[model samples]
Target: MGHPNDDTDKHLRGSLTKQNKKLSRLKCSVHNYDWGIVGNNSQVARLFALNSGSDIDPYKPYAELWIGTHESGPSFVDHGNGRLESLSLKTWISDNPNLVLGERLLRSGAVLSAEKALSIQAHPDKDLAMVLHNSQSSVYRDDNHKPEMALALTEFEALLGFISVKELMDVLCSVPEIVELIGSGNAKQFLLVNEQYRDKNAKAVLQSIFSQLVLSSRNKIGAMISNIKSRLLPEMQKRKLTDKEQLVLRLESQCPADAGVIAAFLLSYVKLNHGEALYLGGNEPHAYICGEYIECMANSDNVVRAGLTSKHRDIQTLLSMLKYTQGFPEILRGVSLNPYTTRYLPPLDEFEIDLSILPQATSVVFPSVPGPSLFLFIKGKGAITAGISENDNVEEGEVLFVPAHTEIRITAESTELHLYRAGVNSRFFTIP
Candidate 1:
């Protein structure tokens, strides 16, 4: 067994959180491979533990961690309950106070992903979450405007928010080649609503126009992509910028610099390493994931994507939930280390954390462990024997998942390790 941890020192935190002293390791629920990982920086987080279940074969550097609940294959872990059980996140956090931090975390989970790029769709506010839930049982998970954050494992790339009308008009005008096909009917509609299009709304309208033109919206936007392949790719060959072009250039071959790229002009691009983090919360929306990242949020699984997904759009659903007036959507967090490790904070309660090196066996116990947690062992192979539990030892790439109110001890016996955790929350308690 590794050194025992003061549960209170490691887990129980708040304003009164007595500044964490002992290096801590909290378990989490990292779901089935989801959004595409940004293969950039990770040696900064230093959390690359040895886990048997990974995609890139022998494991390179630990990238991003996916910890939301969009269903799609929520990661399953070994529950401490005698048998290894798989539980959907939604059912586990019922009435769990920490999980319901003012109806915020759920809002974040319903959106982000790691595998297939999620479609561009907006989520309803509190009232709408209930209304949609009543009207269409499947789409609505809860009624909280979800805002999120993303810290670049290395230079991060994303298509966030909307572009102003003036900027979009310039992009549309640049590619006069397709003006003939833009059709007068919807074209006329755009002119009619032109005044209302501000930032993201304007971008969404442009995407809608482009989506209509795509030889196939439901299919691979392939034909349309092929049509513009020759002309738009010139910029990439001239690629000289150092920071981040939103990494959109990399996807140019796949998406082409069509009306969509311009209409969906990336509002901002950020590159972070070690301790930086991105916050996505409220109704501000964005899509596209590329890199190794650790994502965490509340406990619900529902996403209403419009562009990058093969699911439902619910036009009325998105139109009703958009933050039409929102310009800048989220707050970007910088990196700061806690002695040996670094913690990246997202908008909600959960965080995307990385520990540099595991010293023999450092231990930590949530002063108050969140009721429901599913820990995904992305990397690192170790013998995990929890607090006197009879279970033998868990190896690398194994999920050490625990249910609500499960307080236990953990130790990582490896040179270095990587783990992803989501939905770590607990009720309010006065330090006794």
Candidate 2:
């Protein structure tokens, strides 16, 4: 398959000059992790195949499509001279920070497509991140805190934070295996505290119980898992299982007897329809369980994992770093910037995403923002014009990087265009 942007490159080579080139097409990188959806079944694989003009392997898992300057999976851009992969996006930003990043800092953006559940994990806060990075540089690669948001492109399922104390009590009363694994005495103490305090002491109580659950011996966890499966199998045959029950079975199938299978009951299980979003700040324990979503975070790759992975696990670090907040994660429906654009803004200074749904033959002009923006076109065909640059032809799965202070105009051709624009949060900096 030929590169989709080959003709666009030829047009750019003749028209663009260094002084007027504020927007250029980007070639992003894709990661193939075990949890990813396989081949073209994955949005990541589809987009990557289109952007890179590569043939898909049906057997391969396509996990993440990264569009940023993060060292783990950096993006490249065409410099208008027909060299599509000549310069790294990080190097371009470094060479022109004032023009590219403006007053804002770097951020990481990606599309995550999961087939199976991701690891039960938490990202560290800034202080902990710095300590972890200094102490274990190989694992905690960066010193920046990771505050992230996931905007669902498809039906998404995840476990985020601890469930409310009342909810936890209900699970404990029902799931005897979990109580047994955590020990009958500890479970009784947790139930007593929740019953009396009514969640006022949720953090302390949850921390104690969760610490015990996570610290349980592998043998005990495995035995409890077997007992739960035996109990649930009859229910599965007789009646439809609850979502949490179904999730437990599914996680067990993926990683049989893994501690995450037992630990999952403690966290809030959430299912998001398309366009709904979830925010996970630093020290929040969460796991992405099936589906594809657009994700943006602070530029870091530090994850403290305890279970559901073949990767390195740091149980002590994960237990220490978690916030132990108890509740369901709020699902963001997005605020409308216009009829064509909806913004998913998490409560963080790192990044925010604007989703644009442009109708066919319609044009929308976005005024200059204070920071650089990465535009990912997930659907439809369009032409984008930014600053003094000529219109850049865009199609599904293409990406563009627009520098700071550049007004962008996007015109949808024959179909409605769906794209996500990721940028630094405007609240973080003042335009001077």
lDDT (Cα atoms) of all candidates against the true structure: 0.42, 0.83
Relative to the true structure, candidate 1 reaches a TM of: 0.57
What lDDT tens digits, residue by residue, belong to model 2 across residues 1-432?
Answer: 133375754444334435434677778889999999998799999999888878888999999998877777778876544357545666666656565554243447889999999999999999999999999998888787888899999999999999987888888798998777557887777677635675676677677667777787778778888899999999888999888988999999999868888888889999999999999988999999999999888877889998888889999998888878888889999999988899988887777889999999898888897778888999999988887678878899888887788899999995799988888887777634
Strongest candidate by TM-score? 2
Report the error of model 2 at residue 170, Å.
0.8
Superposed by TM-score, candidate 2 places the C-alpha of residue 29 at a distance from the truth, in angstroms, of 1.1
Question: TM-score per candidate, in order?
Answer: 0.57, 0.92
What's the C-alpha lDDT at position 390 in model 1? Answer: 45
